[model samples]
Target: MKTLKIGNTTVDTVLEWSGNLFDVGAFWPGRSWDAVEAERDWMEPHFIAPKDKSKPGVLAASIHTYVIRTPRHTILVDTCNGNHKTRKTIPPFNNLNTDYMEKMAALGVKPEEVDYVMCTHLHLDHVGWNTKLENGRWVPTFPKARYIFAKTEYDHWFANMNGHAMDGSFEDSVLPVVEAGRADLVENDFAIDDSIWLEPAPGHTPGSVCINLVSGGGSALFTGDCFHHPIQIANPDWSTQFCSDLAGSATARRKIIDKICDTDTYILAAHFMDPTAGRIVRNKDRWKLKI
Candidate 1:
């Protein structure tokens, strides 16, 4: 649990989690055989392999939604896998636990207090908590917040996929907000207020956007799923097989690393081990997470 003042905003929190395979596998469609091999080839040295759920594998980072306190609004970036989310192996997220909300309250922010809700991409986890079960209806989680999304990302993911049947995210996480007139879809480089803006870091997901903040001599980049683990900082080219384009993801990593390293900005990774916030340092012509 570390914090960074990014740009004109304060990225106060990043929640880490651990769960069954279903919670993880659901995101990376081809996670089984390929991901295991990935663990052996690149992840083992820098990470710990999970023995079971109680001792969940660390590589599948249990990280989520970042709370950014901006000058004009309190923004939340990329809500993580939510409670009661249906999956293959992992039981739906903590159906009985109200801690996520509790944590928000402790920080003096209820969903209603959030002025803007921005998502980097609309993966199941990224969008899971966007809506909640209200009297048997899956309704917008942040009742008063405007849910901002990238137009390209929305269209690409909202489009039909190969084998998976689209669940009602279109209905629950997205459409309901739109129907309620709470959604604000914009281009990849959309700006919100002054201190915050979207960085179009595509490839992990077609419309995957990164949130960059700058203010008061501070800056940070909220990298959502661009590089899943700190291990990626070392082997930036080794993308998961499930990535939209492995080569493209690698290229994106190098490009992002170059930009951030050239600056004095702290990185807000959506996933990684504890003390997730760090500076991307160039170690002998290689990038490494310097926590």
Candidate 2:
């Protein structure tokens, strides 16, 4: 777990899993490995796995949640893949049995203690922990918490609920929370308080968003998939294969980089590996993360 203090609030990372999970070629189609290889000096052992004969072009990634404890609220940003969910389309996330809840408990936060559950989007991995299996029925995992979702995002998934690309996550993890009356579908610019709010960052998904936190002279951005890896900092045009609109995703990514580059804001990207927090910096003509 990694902890950071922002103003009077506390942020803790609850990691479910991390590893070299995706093939670079597939993750970023048509992108040349030469560009990524050029940065091997700094990426080795973390962002990009050390080259191995069998697993060439693999990219390191993680699935985790950020627990933000403000003066009055215990908020969770982006719940990772939950345990016992059936994700047939994405084999890696299928029937996961992680100790994610125990990890949260270890952080002194029980399910009922959470004040809000904020999802950046409705992707399979991003919203999987919204609910859990209970008595042969899916139920809201955080019974007392109000799950926040972008209205556009929810509507997109709700309309495509049948055979959606999320591998049944909408029905299993998301719909259950809505049916249980624990969901709050809000606009992309919704704000929880003065210290935290959602910023519109579409492209990966029509309603994708990035949560902003500004408090106590400290600030941070919980970027959901805007930049999956630091490599995107160097190559801002690279959009992941999962992006719904390639051009729009790249545009949003560049806009975000331009907004935070050379600034004090720490970026806590959802898929970044350990030492997951850093600031955006300009390197010569491109951008990079200064951790």
Candidate 3:
């Protein structure tokens, strides 16, 4: 567990996995190799995995959760891919096992101590930890936590819950919590408290949102898949091929970068590799993450 401070609040990172996940061309179809190579001096070995004889030219990402401890609550921003969950479409995340809970316990947070389980969206990776295996059935992992879901986001997926592989995710990861009566469907702009709230940030997903924190004059934005890699900061128009709405994703991505440029607000990226958090800076005509 690594900790950082935002005013009086403390933020801890509990990692699940970090390494090369996909090839650059495969991940960002529209991104030119020249653009990525230009940032090679800064991207090597972390954001962009350096060439290895065995596996060359791969893009890397980290899956982790931000444990935010406010005075009155222990909040989890986004839960990474949970253990033993089914992910057939993406083999890298399929039917896994890991010591994620043990990592959290090391940080002094037990499942029951979690007050709220907030997700930016209901994607397989983001909501996988919402429930766990129990008596051979999916059950809410946090006994005392209230799971928060954005109404628009939930409805979008719920409407097509059976249309694809994601239906399996909703069944195993999301439905169990809602069935337990521990879920709260709120507006995209809902506030958890005076200092913590959600802001509408669509594009990656129709109902995707960013968690905002402002305490003791300090600010940070928990970017939930709005931009998976730091390269997006430099090329805001370069939306990932995985994005369901390319135009909307580009629009929302730029909006977030514009909102944080030259500000003290820390960007806590959900899938950024090491040095996952940083401030946005104006690099001439573009924005760069100053980690």
Residues 86-161 of candidate 3 have per-residue lDDT tens digits of 7888788888899999999999999999999999988888888998998899999899999999999899899878
Tens-digit lDDT track of model 2 for 68-98: 9999999999988889988787778889899
lDDT at position 92, candidate 3:
80
Model 2: weakest 10-residue lDDT segment is 48-57
Task: Report every candidate's CA lDDT.
Answer: 0.69, 0.88, 0.85
Where model 3 places Cα greater than 4 Å from the true spot, the runs are 50-55, 162-167
- Each candidate structure's TM-score, on Cα atoms with residue i matched to residue i, is 0.82, 0.96, 0.95
Predictions ranked by TM-score, top down? Answer: 2, 3, 1
lDDT of 1 by residue, 1-291 (tens): 555655556676646364333223444443443444443533443333544322342244655678888767888988776666554433444342446777777777888888888988876667767877788877888989989999997888667532122244455566667777888889999988567899888878778888888888888888887878766777677666446777777787887898998468877777665556778887676667776
Backbone atom clashes (below 3 Å) for every candidate: 9, 0, 0
**Positional deviation of residue 70's Cα in model 2 after best superposition, in angstroms:** 0.6
1 against 2, candidate with superior lDDT? 2
Model 2 residue 126 lDDT? Answer: 90
TM-score preference between candidates 2 and 3, better one: 2
